[model samples]
Target: MNYAKDPADYPLAAKDPALFVHQHEGAVSWGAVFAGGVGAAAFALILLTLGTGLGLTSISPWSTGASNAKALGFAAVVWVCVTSILTSGLGGYLAGRLRRRWLAVDADEIHFRDTAHGFLSWAVATLFTAAILTSVVSGVVRTGAQTAATTAAASGSVTMEAMQRGNPAAGMNTWPLGYFVDSLFRMPAGSPPPATAATTGSNETPRAETARIFLNSAATGDPLSPEDTAYLSQLVAQRTGLAPDAAQARVTTTYTRLLQKISAMNTAAKSAADEARKITIGVSLWLFISLLMGAFSASLMATYGGRVRQL
Candidate 1:
């Protein structure tokens, strides 16, 4: 009833008495696999460090002599492929050379075992390197997030005040309604502009109110309501010494320009996102190719090592 207990059920073992005698010994040489894997990982780390140093030397901080990003990326990919082949071949050779040789196993079975050993070694090395990199990346991300949080906490009130007052010097990219609000206060040609400090002090509430109206319109993708338009025009006229009619026209023109700018920003953002997606896909494919190179190199070198062992 038990397959292992009855040797009669195993046709090959029944015919070959020598194979039955050594059947108890396991096929895999775990010690060899582990040694090869650790050696490969260490060698890979050394190669990576060397490559990084070489790459840094090739690049220049000054624009004239510096290698462009695209060129650097291509060089990195080539270096990765080279590193994979060298490291994996070394691992495979060690695994095959050090593995326990079989006395009674068939040639085909021996070949398969050697191949398996090579593959396992490569897998272990890859996993070890990945774990190391993952931990490093996680630590860096945590540190960066903590730094950003601290900076934001310290500057929160100042940033909010600057945004509300439509301060042009307060990082334009951070304030969504800044351009539109500033357009509202633009004076006619040859007219002197208002003093920034005086305007900020006296019209703080009105500036904040106008920014809110612009933000709401932008969010809703709708033009300002008639009441809001009239009120904003009156406020603009009072602030800029313009006629009511001119202020109303300016408001209409500025709101139209704001919508156009928003549409342009959305398009640019989508384009940037699409570009990033393509780059990610390209990098992933290259990584896959590099891994395949490692597997093939390892298997080939392991077969060579096994043949040498027989000699």
Candidate 2:
């Protein structure tokens, strides 16, 4: 027995067209759902626009950075919930209101079927809107990636130069290791040289070579060889106009300073990135919860609306 066959052929058909057979009650009612879905989508778009205007009014670029970041995120969440509630509620209610009335069915079945129609309306509208939005988002991301690549190769030189002239206090967030390395090599103005000066007072030969060695060591993270260190001390002496002994001392001190700064910078950057990731996850979780609540509120409201006797 195909269990799904016309009950009229079976022992149960004539008993009551009302009771046992499930012919889907013309219940799908595609036409009504499409209508409701369209209405819902229109409502959703309207709400989205309204939300955007309100959100913009809540933020300003000139305000404190931390405050603005929080405000923008909060405003966005509120708008999302508002859009979901109003649009979904309107769509679901319209679906129930417009569905064809069922014949030969009990009140319970009628109510159940009616509510199902409303839910279907919401589901259909949500899917339609998501599809549209996905295409838009994909386009946006593609453009953003292209722009990022182009700017990275062009205007990025200015930003890189600015960053390299990095503030010892604030801008040090990006590269702690590099910052620390550079810090070790800096010398105070008017300091005596650590090692013997070059034969020419203006020519600091040892210090120049030491700088080359320092750069190599920093780039590769390899400790300087004794020869390299000795060469640097000589250069430091000549550059600072110091005797051999003082130049050697200055060179050693500067080298040690660079190592310490780099280590500290590395740790600070790792910690900051980790904190940002955690904050992002927390916001995402909240958004998910708000979405679910909006859906539930819309569905329950539709169910109630469906029960309203056709005044």
Candidate 3:
């Protein structure tokens, strides 16, 4: 009756020596890992979508919208961290609780296996989320590129038709090289200004040349030369039918205004870049911290879940 105490007297136990040997199945449970991973990814995606909706609600196209970019970025970072903690904790708990029990295993090994399951679940969930996001972003970018290309082709065809109909200025407004061509055929100050299409061939060339000059000045951080200023003034006088002194004053005023605009644009660009850099750095740091917290939470929760399951 008591086989442990009387194995020698038991006929079946005496006939089979292999029956006493203990066999260990595999340590890792892929099923539990996958289940937890899927749950975590789904939960994270739902939370992120909700956060996006909330964020969008706070923003508006009108001037009255909450447009503080830095504040929005900070809130996004915080939300992501919170999502990670909650999702990872839940996933780890499920993994540990759902995993099949190991017979005749030491307490230390059980703890190690529980922690490993939690970590693996977190890794799988993170990878799944990243893959989904990458695919979505790639699809959006591809669609946008195709739409832009089609629109550009259509606009180009329309511009060519306008040029054929003798409207040279139709596309010149968007051309950066038009300014240089305009300067090549500058009219003398005393010449009669062309008032109509019949009198003036096309003002596109002159306008283009002016744009090139301004672009060059902006790029090189230099003012127009004295000779260029004089020549431009003469061109203005002929084109606008103004006195020489009046044309010169107008040119000077225009140059001053352009310089002010360029300065303001440069200042705004630098400010934006600085703000973006700060946001990027802050987000990266917070993300790293959040991931660490997630890992800790998941491992701790898994051990607790495993203990509860044993009970």
Clashes of each: 0, 17, 8
lDDT of 3 by residue, 1-311 (tens): 53254434444445664433322357878898888889989999999999998776656566343355645766788888899999988888988898877654567988998999888888888889889999999999999999987987666533322332333344344332233234334454577655677655466555655655555554555777887778877877766666788777776666666566556666887898998898789878998888887787778777877777667
Tell me which of candidates 1 and 2 scores higher on lDDT. Answer: 1
Candidate 1 backbone collisions, by pair: none
* Shift in Å, residue 192, candidate 3: 14
Number of the candidate with higher lDDT, 1 or 3? 1
TM-score to true structure, per model = 0.80, 0.67, 0.73
Query: What is the alpha-carbon lDDT of model 3 when measured against the actual structure?
Result: 0.70
Task: Rank candidates by TM-score, best first.
Answer: 1, 3, 2
Best by lDDT: 1
How well does candidate 2 score on lDDT at residue 249? 72
Residue 15 CA displacement from its true place in model 1, Å: 18
- Per-residue error (Å), model 3, residue 81: 1.9
Clashes of 2: 17
lDDT of 1 by residue, 1-311 (tens): 54374555556678876666665688888887888788888999999999888777766676553356666778889999999999999998888888876655678988888898889889888999899978988999999999988987676433433443444334233545666777787777777867778567677667667767766666657888999999999999988888999999999888888778767777887898998999899899999999999988887777778767756
Worst 10 residues of 1 by lDDT: 164-173
